[model samples]
Target: MNWLLVIVGAMVGAPLRYLTDRTVQSRHDSLFPWGTFTVNMAGCLVLGLLTGAAAAGAASSHLQLLLGTGLCGALTTYSTFSYETLRLAKEGAGRYAVANVAGSVAVGLAAAFAGAWLAG
Candidate 1:
């Protein structure tokens, strides 16, 4: 049952992630990896919300597995982020690479905190 839920959730999340990345990336001319950053931050915020809901006893373990483990896990891609950052650095866009790492961390944390606060 849990595995099924995970697969179901991933079915939605994976396509959504790809579409979102393409939509966001299409708007930017730079190689700052805005798409990956956006997805990561969004995933963080969602996980925070799920965590808060769990803490508040509003979300069941099954729900957590489906949404958090399944959806968020599929929607966010650490591999892509790492690859893009390294690509940027290799292409001499070292500043952009650094910015991507720092910005993603700061913004992702803040977004997660905000989501948790809102859920709480």
Candidate 2:
């Protein structure tokens, strides 16, 4: 049952993530990976909210698996982020690569913290 919920959540999250990335990337023509960054930060915020809900006993274990593990797991892509950054650096966009890394980490963290605080 938990696995099914996870699958269902992933089904929604994965496509939504792709769609979001496409929409966001379509707006920008820069070397910076705005799509990937947006999805990752959004994913962090969602997961943080879920965590806070769980901490407050507002979420059940199944909900956690569905949203946190399944949705967020498929929604966020560390591998893609890493690969994009590497590709940027290899393609002579070293500054953009560094900026992506630094900005993603810093902003992602802040978003997560904010989400948790707001939710809690």
Candidate 3:
């Protein structure tokens, strides 16, 4: 049952991530990997909201499993983000690569905080 949730969540989240990445990449002309940044920030927000809801006893364990373990695990993809950052660095876009890393971290944190506050 839990595994099913993870699989379903991954199915939804992965495509959403891909679409978001493609959309951002299409709009931006830079090699800064804005797609990764967007996804990570969005993922952080979702995770924070889930945490707040769980902490407030507004959600059940199964709901946590679905949202936190399944949805969040699927939504927050560190591997793709890392790969893109490295690719940018390897292509000699040092500043953009660094920005990708730093910006994602900073924005992700801020989004998470915002989501938690909103949910609370």
Candidate 4:
């Protein structure tokens, strides 16, 4: 049952991730990976909300397994983030690489906290 839930969630999440990444990336002319950033932050916020809700007893373990473990796991891509940062650096866009790291960390944390607060 748990595996089924996770698979279903991933089935939805994977395509959502790809579509969202493409959609967000298309709008920007900059070399910075805005799509990856957006998805990561969104995933963090969603997981934060799920965690908070779980803590508050408003969410169940099944929900966490589905959305947090499966959906968020598929939605966020650390590999892509790392690859993009490395690509930026190798392409002589070191500043954007640094900014991407710094901004993603900072904003990701903030978004997670904000989501938790909102849910709680």
Clashes of 2: 0
Model 1: lDDT to the true structure: 0.93
Model 4 agreement with the true structure over 1-120: per-residue lDDT tens digits: 999889988988899899999999999999999999999999999988998898899999999999998899899999999999999999999999999999999999998998889899
lDDT of all predictions, in order shown? Answer: 0.93, 0.93, 0.82, 0.94
What is the total number of backbone clashes in candidate 1? 0
Across 1-120, the per-residue lDDT of candidate 3 in tens digits comes to: 878877777777778888888998899998787777887888899988877887788877777777777767776789988998899889998888888888888988888888888888
Question: Which has the better TM-score: candidate 3, or candidate 4?
Answer: 4
Output the lDDT of residue 115, model 1. Answer: 80
User: What lDDT is obtained when candidate 2 is compared to the true structure?
Assistant: 0.93
| lDDT (Cα, 0-100) at 52 in candidate 4 | 85
TM-score of each: 0.98, 0.97, 0.91, 0.98
* Rank by TM-score (best first): 4, 1, 2, 3
Off by over 4 Å in 1: none
Give the higher-lDDT candidate: 3 or 4. 4
Cα-based RMSD of candidate 3: 1.3
Off by over 4 Å in 3: none
